[model samples]
Target: MCSTVVTPTDRVQPDVALPFGGWSAIVRDMSEEQSTSEPTRAFREARDFLLAHREDYETAYRDFDWPRFDRFNWACDWFDALAVEQPGVAALTIVEEDGEVNSLTYAEMAERSRQVAGWLTGAGLQPGDRVLIVLGNTIPLWEVMLACIRAGAVMIPATTLLTDADLADRITRGGVRAVVTSSSEAPRYEGIADHCIRVGIGGPVDGWLDYEDSRGYDGPVPEVDTAAHDSLLLYFTSGTTSQPKLVEHTQVSYPVGHLSTMYWIGLQPGDVHLNVSSPGWAKHSWSNVFAPWNAGATVFLCNYTRFDAEKMLQVLATYGVTTFCAPPTVWRMLIQADLSAVEIQIRECISAGEPLNPEVIEQVRNAWDVTIRDGYGQTETTAQIGNPPGQPVKLGSMGRPLPGYSIALVDPTTDEVGDDGEICIELAPPPVPLMRGYRDAKELTEESMRGGFYHTGDVASRDEEGYITYVGRSDDVFKASDYRISPFELESVLIEHPAVAEAAVVPSPDPVRLAVPKAYVVLAAGREPSRELAGEILQFCRDHLAPYKRIRRIEFAELPKTISGKIRRVELRADEAAKVDGGERTEHSYDEADFKQA
Candidate 1:
């Protein structure tokens, strides 16, 4: 809550005490028209090194160094520098479904964000004020995000798909002081507290400030003296297992930490990068905002009401997209279409959000001759592990650790480093990409950082070659018949079956075996749910999986998913347990015993 704004003539001495329990080297008072600042220079050097060695993974990983600076605002230091240097470069491009394309240059975006910052500041937006953003993939989302960075306000991004209860929970838990959402979404906040500073986009709403009003304000905004560790973004996780914890990021964590993500995606200057992700999630900020911009790549978006795989493919080909990133679900849907029909210019393709199945990867590679590299990380950190460009990608592996991240897979119970265990990032040296900590949850944060490492709840195994293959979440991986079972491994094989569109594997209660693997599956398009189809799918798993890890039950039904598109296996597990207690079974549920009796 420290407002360390200083004027051009006010030069404070080093190690100024901040009220927020941090020490700043200096209270920076920078002019917009000034030449390249020290922070800008240092950041550019790190970014340029990655771009220079984009294809050379070993050299980049070994020789690269994170940019170290005391005072840095990515919007002010890096993005604004790019605007001054390459004013006419396309920074963002949004292609609407109706053939409308809107593109903004670096200078234009910088100026707009500056105007927004000035307007928000004039309206009494103070430093450390948390603003909840519930907008979509429009131009204003980027503007407001950058403006908040410029104005020194913390951002809490929420998805428009959130329900009223979800909104209330976020508003209360996030301690949101302001909200910027679309005019249509403004009414959704009617039941929430009315004390928040609400701004509506696209149109006017009663009692809400109009976002369009910022266009008239072109005055100078106050300079923000943001320290490296100041809170910038507060993300609400998908909560696949439990309630979503507020993941806090500092000025350096995501804005600068995404240098690793930039490297993972293999983005370069002037490259058109298309990332299929909805707003409000971490990956959206990862690929759509920071990573592409960090590499000076054009952030491209194909805005469509509904996803059309052919149209998405055509858009990539038409726009000459050089690098593309999408979730595993999108990849699965894209491969279902005729990929060979559209010849895309995408040089790099990556998948995140969840582990990409090898079947989906193979299909895309076979059709487009471009391998889809899988990467690993959570909302708590940036891309910690990934298959960078020019690396030998191992099938079904998320690949090696990126630069600036020291990964250690440790046994959960023993906390011993090993080849197969829970994925943990070393805390010694504190990688710049890691989050500040979980906000308002000291115990949870302490637990995560307990054993000299930031423990990722997900588990994985490392090969002798150092490549990492994702296992299931630590809670999701259960034991059946005295054998450990990875739900991801089982689900991956389940999806390989042609009829299964999506699947979630969880343990079902059993009196004899303690528990057995049960798969809840969603059928592919034109596929119907039937006993014969379930038998065939189970047979597919039986053939592909080991006897111990075989899926014992199959239910042809929609799998529960978080709004971020992650399968909620915890819910599925609870449902199975409840059913066992009640002596109930779902209508579409089929068991291996039925086939055995037949």
Candidate 2:
């Protein structure tokens, strides 16, 4: 058993007497040292600049300078330097579904990555070569990731859930020169490319290189010289509207951008951080890879094929998770379970990916005595706006901008700064954390970066306190009879109904009103998808919402979502529009027709 003690509020400090055997120990000591060391002039200067105009958007927007570095390798400069003395520190703790657990110390992970790097280099993988990595939440995933980073090679991380078509598109579009995947997935890449080398994990395959043999290679790993601006990752965005666009990140972009994420999570050295996210997506990297590790906290992972709120709660209590982050969907599911029976040691709870409904936040706070803080960002950047520690968290607002980010709300039509409009980053030259650009789409990239801002393509409203409240996406919010209807707003209210497990609201075309609100709802586990339940939800909407915003039509169906688990509102809207075009019209909706009498 671990001897480190933790308070309800304060983080666990480094255990000096504990055996320094893993990645966790190395990170903890490093974080502890950095926290006490006098802040560098550069760090102080950058921090002061951010504090000076924490809420003064106009001034910060004009005055702030993004920190620049001509030579910086995060692994070598920060991680490896810190790992030298703390060889036994635990770096990663992974709990499998069947209760089996695996851990790696910082020193062990570093050496393993070095060996993998040596093996990869010996196999003719060169710096800047793109390698497609598709694997689950496993040790080899992290080993190969660090190896790729050390090798100065770009990686395209793909989720194993992707289909053959998805893999084909990524291989072609990403210009993948190699692939490192499980032996189970070797068949997917059979005919793709002859030049692409396949490094299979978990036993040898007939045509693929064995990952276990990589451990035996006696070759010394060469340090590849890498610049901050070199491409490091190419992420294909989960397509909610159109085809997935390849988002390019530089060596410094994510490595540095995650500073914002670290601050947002309020992670500290020796803290055990658990983030609920799948492999391959940006959020996974945000919490699982960069944020916790950046802060020298233990990356605690609980892997399950299906989400089990009870099982997760047990892990949090058993593993002593100090900080926890999850999307709203998971939080909503947890709310349905009896949280009172679960013991959680979490110091802070955070929500991301989508705007967390205020009801869910309040419910968790009531039960767990911890606020579920909301945060906002995209695949293109790290946590931009979030409710940080020691800050007042408004009920529904995603809090103020972080240290390195400068957020602006510009009116879409006027292109002038405003209290309510499209969110943008007003950088003279874009910040280091911002993606290099959408890969190979010069026209799209140019258009997005125009108007002196990196347009987020999402809408929001900023109040006097600088807390930004998310509105629907630019395309998701539609005008019904000249009144702007935010689907997210209505959906938030809709999900509060007992029958609704999930909900997506969109505009349904109407001749008289131009458009009307329609809801596609997924029923809760025990609830049947019937007209009676639909009528109850529709009535619930009418009781809570304004007449104009009340859901006029409801369809019992599963909400369409991107593979990343974000609801595809664009697809929902397109389907509604098609229904209208097909002349499938509702004569009387819930409000117009008296359902109470029936």
Candidate 3:
């Protein structure tokens, strides 16, 4: 086992963790020195096993064990340990719009983080204090995250895109004691609670302290000890249907738990990884922070105010990004560009945030000769299922369960395990990556963690080979003509049409069939919303989908989405329900019957 296992960046131990106080006291008594901690050796052994068998999924799955340790800190343990051995290695790199590139070596990052941790300690931040970090993909972001982890403080990562209202909600619910954001965003924090400490990046502010000052703090700070189960981060989920849930993760849960995510992305030591996600969300941490770092890979970021696929490709080519992860929305836009015009250095490409549409995957393979593997995870857990490297990717399948995850499909009606049903995880051996629970919502958390399983609230179908196909969200799946319907199945087929840019399928009410598939589509830039175009799209779906799955109603309008860029099918479902007289044609809507009569 390597020295990165149980080591932390800090050299001193605190009396207790913030808010929750001292779970660390016991951990402290058990082991004062982590260099020889038994649990740390176990964790290193587990991590090395996955990396050793990155492509051999069957052997890795059969052997991987979730490392259990009472005292663990990723910053000092894994990252700084690597710095000691490979100090000059690149840890993080960012490319600006005007071609200004900034990078930090592993040693530089570790020491800089220690400086920030020392500064934060001077600011009276103690263990367990919730620090809400709101910054762009700046170097300070990484510094602050490591500082918080080293201090045994709970870090709440927020995107700069979050509104002032979102910050208020998080502060109230998350009990934030400190906030770090840019000076331009400082005005948003006006009249916030006086208890919250504000640290501004870039320039300075009247009442805010400049983040640049952290570099001046050359003082030493002791390593803060936190238990494996102590709260480390509180993530506010991007709500697609209901209000956002405050998902909590302990120290090991995310830092150590992302071993699966590391395996899923097929990250290797010294690989340059570029993950397309803004700060604040779970996926950003998944690929950008934990997964890549777990494998000793360098994280690359291309900062852009506005997305340009061609420009991004140029950056990817320049940076020699070995591994890449992007959301399906970004993938769809990339397919729109002339992929052949640009060169890409990315060897492994993965898609998440939403299921990968097969058409998008195929187009990229045709253009780049690399398959875009799909992965499935959420704010609640690390990468649980993914099409890992070297595996034959079955189109539309999100691969088999990654090591450390025990997946089961349970029929909601029967509550019995089967080939298809609600996707759940076995709790007998609860996966290490799974979140503790939704903060302050015991009822909701219990409901989600019932039956000795963690219910994912999504549905999927499993094959004999253990490959699972995402059906749809549990609520989004409906019955049409006495047959079960998966919106994803219909939507995937609909996007294959050349005229469709993006598509969302919902159950449209019908008198005869009780309900029928209706597609709410956004047309490609050059296409018109005429009945003629609608006929071609419906015909395309009819030829590919089952008879019952055929889209009977078409609405060529902009699809509604949440702030986080998820297609809000619930809103579309409600709009269809609002229609009177059973069903009637609306603006830009074309029924299949009208097109057939043509």
Q: Indicate which candidate wins on lDDT.
A: 1
Q: Give the distance in Å from residue 33's predicted Cα in candidate 2 to where it truly belongs.
A: 17
lDDT of 1 by residue, 119-162 (tens): 99888789999999998999899999999999899999989999
Candidate 2's displacement at residue 152, Å, is 0.7
lDDT for each residue of candidate 3 in 156-196, tens digit (9 for 90 to 100): 99888787788899888889999998888888888784678
For model 3 the local lDDT of residue 473 reads: 90
Residue 402 of model 2 has an lDDT of 70
- Model 1 weakest 10-residue run by lDDT: 1-10
Number of clashes in model 3? 12
The TM-score of predicted model 1 comes to 0.92
Candidate 2, superposed: residue stretches over 4 Å from native:
1-66, 583-598
lDDT of each: 0.85, 0.78, 0.84
Estimate the TM-score of every prediction. Answer: 0.92, 0.89, 0.92
> Which candidate order results from sorting by lDDT in descending order?
1, 3, 2
Please identify which of the two predictions, 2 or 3, would achieve the higher lDDT against the true structure: 3
Pairs clashing in candidate 1?
Answer: none
